[model samples]
Target: MHKQIIFNLPVKDLEKSKAFFTAVGFTFSQKFSNDQAAFMHIVGDDIRAMLMTETFFNSLINKPVVNAKEGNEVIICLSCESRAEVDSLIAKATAAGARIPHPPEDHGFMYDQGFEDLDGHLWNLVWAETGV
Candidate 1:
């Protein structure tokens, strides 16, 4: 059985992507990082994300890269402890050169904010009420 999982994402610039994610509170694993890719540690058990340069990622896959800005291919969602935490991350990301795709929205049960990373990848930061 597999004990660990890693999600690989194609990026335009390795350094920029690393800097952006770092600013948004993610630490990288230097052991897996190099000029071509960076390993970002997500806040979960046995989960890591790899940010690979466009050329490097393309060399590994036959399919063309998804234009993340043209449309939504996927929405990476993360759960935060509080709404303030969500806002804080959004602010930090924006300050680090990420683009705000939309304003924060409240749905009573959940609060969500979105930002586009340096490579146009969309990330949704959410805080959901778990108590009934």
Candidate 2:
């Protein structure tokens, strides 16, 4: 059985990608990171995101890399412990130059907020009221 999931994403600049995600509170795995790629460590899960440079990443795939800011591909959603955590991360993301596509939405049982990273990757921060 598969116990872990590692997602690979393309980035234009490795250093800038590192800084952006660092601001988002994710650490890097030095063992899997180098000049062309970075392994972003996601806490509480074995799912790590491999941030690879466009050229290096393209070599591994058959299709060309899309311009993220111009086209949407995927949105990475993270579960938060509370609304406060969601708000805090959103602030950090915006401060780190991420653009907020829309304001946060709150329902009786859930709250959702998100931002687009430097490379235009959309990340959603969500919180669900426990016991729901």
Candidate 3:
């Protein structure tokens, strides 16, 4: 059984990407970070993301990298404890140069807000309480 999971995404600038995510309330593990890639910690579990440069990422895969700004490649969704947390994270991301792709969604029990990171990666912040 696998105990940990990691997702890889490409970024043009490692320093800039790290700064952006840091301002948006995310942390990184310097042990896995290098000139070619950075390991971003998702905060709770062993789930981490490797932010690799396009050149390095290409070396690992045999396909053309997609321009995330033109079209989204994936939407990374995160669950928050409350609606305030969802709103706060989105606000922080936006303040850190992320764009709000759309308006926040309120489904009574579940609330969602999202933004596109500096590298144009889509991230959805969702909040839902028990017995809401």
Candidate with top TM-score is: 2
Which regions of candidate 1 are displaced past 4 Å? 1-3
Residue 87, model 3: lDDT of 89
Ranking according to TM-score, highest score first: 2, 3, 1
C-alpha lDDT of all candidate models, in order:
0.88, 0.90, 0.90
Candidate 3 TM-score to native = 0.94
Which number leads on lDDT?
A: 2
Which digits, one per residue and each the tens of the lDDT, describe model 1 over residues 1-132?
997778889988798788888888899989988999898998865778999999999999999988777776788887889999999999999999989978999998899999999888888999999983
Local error of candidate 1 at 44, Å? 4.7
Q: Report the C-alpha lDDT of model 3 over 1-132, residue by residue, as the tens digit.
A: 997779999898989999999998778888889999999888566788999998999899889888899997679998898899998998899899999989999999899999998889899999886876
Model 2 misplaced regions, further than 4 Å: none
| Weakest 10 consecutive residues of candidate 2 by summed lDDT | 39-48
TM for every model, in the order presented, reads: 0.91, 0.95, 0.94
